[model samples]
Target: MTTSTYHGIYAVVSRIPRGKVATYGQVALLANLPGRARLVGYALSALTDPSVPCHRVINAKGEISRRNGGSEADEVQRHRLEVEGVFFDSHGRIPLELFRWRLYADE
Candidate 1:
């Protein structure tokens, strides 16, 4: 993807509301980049915007990706989620059935 596309994905991810979570696939799809979930991850991994809340994204299975090279990134994500009152199960996966964002039909 081009730099513009990456910026577009970042914009979409930035719009995700607090206390809600979007999957990597969801952000990609929302940005009109189907099947580019990993691209979304890549974009977010490079994120520097404090307002973006990039940590609110995870895998489709509701598990935060451990792509930052260690458990430290995962711990940081979990800590952020906890700060937002997002409870995780014993397996460290968010219960998407309960906390997943319900995007509007027109969104």
Candidate 2:
């Protein structure tokens, strides 16, 4: 049987809006699985569905984490985010304060 954690991770990640980002830790927290940021990263890397927009998920540092196997995937993630109108600083990090998606229960 698939664990709730697996479903929770994908559901939370899917809620991140276009033009905004969420950290892996934030995703886990939102999914009610605190201290499971690494698991969030693993779930994202295993995703193959473009509809999920896994690239919208970033690290806590606001830097794009290298997806599983290669640097090329990193570039692709950056490009995907850029196309969605997210901006990165010269240090190659998204300004989380501005672009981080705020998921509220009432919204």
Candidate 3:
């Protein structure tokens, strides 16, 4: 993806409020790049900005996705969410109905 695409993704991601989460597909669509959910994940993985809050973007299943199947980053993301007053259920997934950041009116 171009740097501009990543910038657009970053812009949308930066808007996700504390204690709320958006799915990768949601971020991709909000950034005007439809059907580029994995691209959103890639851009976020590449981002180094502390203000972006990439950890706030979870999977569509409301589960924290692991990088390279590693739990270290997943743990950090979960901890950050917890610190922001977002709770995880016994299944270790965020309840999307409660914590999803829906930008659309009809969603």
Question: Best-fitting candidate, measured by TM-score?
Answer: 3
Lowest lDDT 10-residue stretch of candidate 3? 98-107
- Pairs of residues clashing in candidate 1: none
The residue pairs in collision within model 3 are: none
- Please write out the lDDT profile of model 2 over residues 29-102, one tens digit for every residue: 99988998998887876777777878888899999887556669899889999999999999999998889887
Ranking by TM-score: 3, 1, 2
Top-lDDT candidate index = 3
lDDT of 1 at 100: 83
**Residue 51 lDDT in candidate 1:** 78
In candidate 1, position 101 carries an lDDT of 76
State the displacement of the C-alpha of residue 38, model 3, in Å, after optimal TM-score superposition: 0.7
Higher-scoring candidate on TM-score, 2 or 3: 3
Clashes of each: 0, 0, 0
Query: Model 3: per-residue lDDT, tens digit, 1-107?
Result: 46998999999988888888999999999999899899998898888989888989999999998888555988988999999999899999999999999776323
Which residue runs does candidate 3 get wrong by more than 4 Å?
Answer: 69-71, 104-107
Q: Candidate 1: worst 10 consecutive residues by lDDT?
A: 98-107
